[model samples]
Structure formats: C-alpha cells, structure tokens
Target: MRYIISYVSTVNPNISNSDMTALMDYVRLNNNAIGLMGILIYSEGNFFQILEGEEQTVKMMFEKIRKDYRHHNIIKMLDKEIISSSFSESRSSFTVISDHYNQSELHQFLKKEEEHNPEHYKSISYLAQKFMKFN
Candidate 1:
C-alpha cells in the first residue's frame, strides 16, 4: 500500500546554506534509493515536506526525519494511505524546493493536483505558507 506524510518544521536558525544543501543531498539520495517520491521545501526558516512510498518505507523515513538534528519543532501535518504520490511525475523521485519559490503558487498547484485524486488527505501546503511568514 502507498502512504504519504506531510510535515512542517522550523529550520535550525544557525544552519548555513551549504549545510542545508548537504542535508538535502543526503536525504534525496536516501529517498531515491528506497523508491520514495516527495518534495522538501525550505522557505524563510521553515520546512514543508511530503513523502510517499510503501507504507513501511514512508514510516521509516518519517522516523529518520523526526530524529534528524537539522530541524526542530517537528509537526506531522498530513498522513494518509494514498493511491499515489502527487510527486510521482517528477523525473527525480525526491526534490529539494528552495532558493526560490512562491508560496501561493505552490499551494494552488498542490490543491489542484489533490482535486484529481481521491480526497483521502488534506492539503498542508497552506500551513507551509503560514509557517514561512513567521521568519
């Protein structure tokens, strides 16, 4: 069965750009190796991420994220048994969305995609936007 989990977290304020890049690279490599498809977005000191794959795989990844020291205040926003991942269309199964992104655009894009799928999960990209507004 496929499963997806979305979460929001505060980036460690002291982390440097190079550090973040290293973190993303490490995560992307691991996720792709395990056939996970997802997006990790960092905006203005916060992170919004979604991960999807086999149920056990997704859960294991989330556990690793929870223990990761790069971020804090981890909050699981959305979790569901899904039919498929919204990110499966990407050539790279795992991607890092940072450097530049439009919050409203991202929200609308995810919302629109969700409309075409089973309504088993709620969209949390809005919360991603809301979190980015803080700092």
Candidate 2:
C-alpha cells in the first residue's frame, strides 16, 4: 500500500546553505534508490516535507530523520494510507523558499490542488501554504 507522511522540523541554526544543499542531495539520492518520492520545502530555517512510499520504507525513513542532528522538534503533521502518490517522479524534489520564483510556483501548484481536491487537501496542505509564507 502507498503511504504518505508529512512532517515539519526546525533546521539546526548553524547549518549553512551549502550544507543544506548537500544534505538534500543525499536525501534525494537515497530516497530515489528506495522508491520514495516527495517534495521537501525549506523556508526560514524550517522544513516541511511530504514523503510517499511503502509503509515500512517510509516509517524507517521517518525514524532516521527523527534522529538526524541537522534538525530538531520534528513533528509529524500527517500519516495516512493514500490511494496514489502525489509525486511520482523518479527523484524527490527539493525547494528552498528563499527563491521567490520557485516558491511562488509551488504555492500556486498546491493552491490549485487544494481547490480541486478540497477533502484531501486538509491540514497538511494548509500547513504547506503557511510554511511557504514564512520568511
């Protein structure tokens, strides 16, 4: 079954841009190899991620993320068995909200989804919208 897990965490204050890029690169590569697909959004030292994959694989990844020192106060916002993967691309996507162009584009994309699927676009979608607005 396909599972979706959404979580938020504060980025360690000391991590630099280059470090964040490297960290995301590692995550994307690993996730791709393991059949995971999702989008990771970083904004103002906070991370909002949505991962979709097999139950055990996604759970195992969440556990590793919980122990990672690069972030703290990890709070899972959503965990549900979904009908299909929202992101089915080969590799996981990463977006740093500092880039206004990309950030706005993502926000628009989610907003469109929210309008079309109001029921499924609940708390997680709201939280993503709010996270995108963070400076």
The top-ranked prediction according to TM-score is: 2
Off by over 4 Å in 2: 88-101, 108-119, 122-124
Model 1 stretches with alpha carbons more than 4 Å out = 89-92, 100-135
Candidate 2 clashing pairs, residues 3+ apart or interchain: none
Error of 2 at 54 (Å): 0.4
Report the poorest 10 consecutive residues by lDDT, candidate 1: 116-125
State in Å the error of residue 111, model 2: 6.5
* Tens-digit lDDT track of model 1 for 54-91: 89999998998888787799989888897755654554
TM-score of each: 0.72, 0.75
Cα deviation of 33 in candidate 2 (Å)? 2.4
Model 2 scores what on Cα lDDT?
0.74
